[model samples]
Target: MKEKKSMIEEEKEDHLKSTKRIEMEEQLANPDEEPQEVISEKEEY
Candidate 1:
């Protein structure tokens, strides 16, 4: 049970990292746009 819980935790961390990477790529693609993703995430939380 402990191992399964830990796996879930690790997966959550990986998802956050991947989401951040995707946002960064989006910023790169739209260099002229402001970094609004960060602000949006804060609002979501």
Candidate 2:
């Protein structure tokens, strides 16, 4: 039972890591676009 719990925890950690990696990649891919998005949000306000 402990082994199964550990495996589930590891899977959750891996999923979180993967999502962080994806967000990092997106930021890297659109380093300029992010500023534009922020600017648009400010303009809306």
Candidate 3:
């Protein structure tokens, strides 16, 4: 049925969004201790 298919798609989308949120939270919780090295470059017009 069309309704059943739509429900399954919605569930899949919700699961994907949740997983991405969890990954982001984990990264925020444990940040890198080392300072990031940057290479300064002259801006070109």
Candidate 4:
């Protein structure tokens, strides 16, 4: 049971890291778009 739980946690962390990496790649691909997106997101808050 402990081993299974640890495996699940590891998978979650890996998934989050991968998602962040993808976002970074997209931002890099379109440097101009990212700033506008960020500004709008901040305005929402």
lDDT, candidate 3, 1-45, per-residue tens: 999999999999999898677656655664652112111121232
Summarize candidate 4's per-residue lDDT along 1-45 as a digit string, tens digits.
999999999999999999788768768887877756865776899
Estimate TM-scores for all models. Answer: 0.68, 0.66, 0.64, 0.69
What is the alpha-carbon lDDT for the whole of candidate 3?
Answer: 0.61
Question: What would the TM-score be for candidate 3 when compared with the true structure?
Answer: 0.64
Segments in model 3 whose C-alpha atoms lie over 4 Å from true places: 33-45
lDDT of 2 by residue, 1-45 (tens): 999999999999999999678667766887876745654775899
Clashing pairs in 4: none
Each prediction's Cα RMSD? 3.7, 6.0, 9.7, 4.2
Residue 40 local lDDT, model 2 = 71
Please give the clash total of every predicted structure, in order. Answer: 0, 0, 0, 0
**Which stretches in model 4 have alpha-carbon errors above 4 Å?**
35-45
What is the TM-score (0 to 1) of candidate 1? 0.68
Best by lDDT: 1
Cα displacement (angstroms), candidate 1, residue 20, comes to: 0.3
In model 2, state the lDDT of residue 28: 85
Superposed model 1: Cα runs more than 4 Å off = 35-45
Evaluate residue 25 in candidate 2 and report its C-alpha lDDT on the 0 to 100 scale: 75
User: What are the lDDT scores of the predictions, listed in order?
Assistant: 0.83, 0.79, 0.61, 0.82
lDDT of 2 at 3: 100
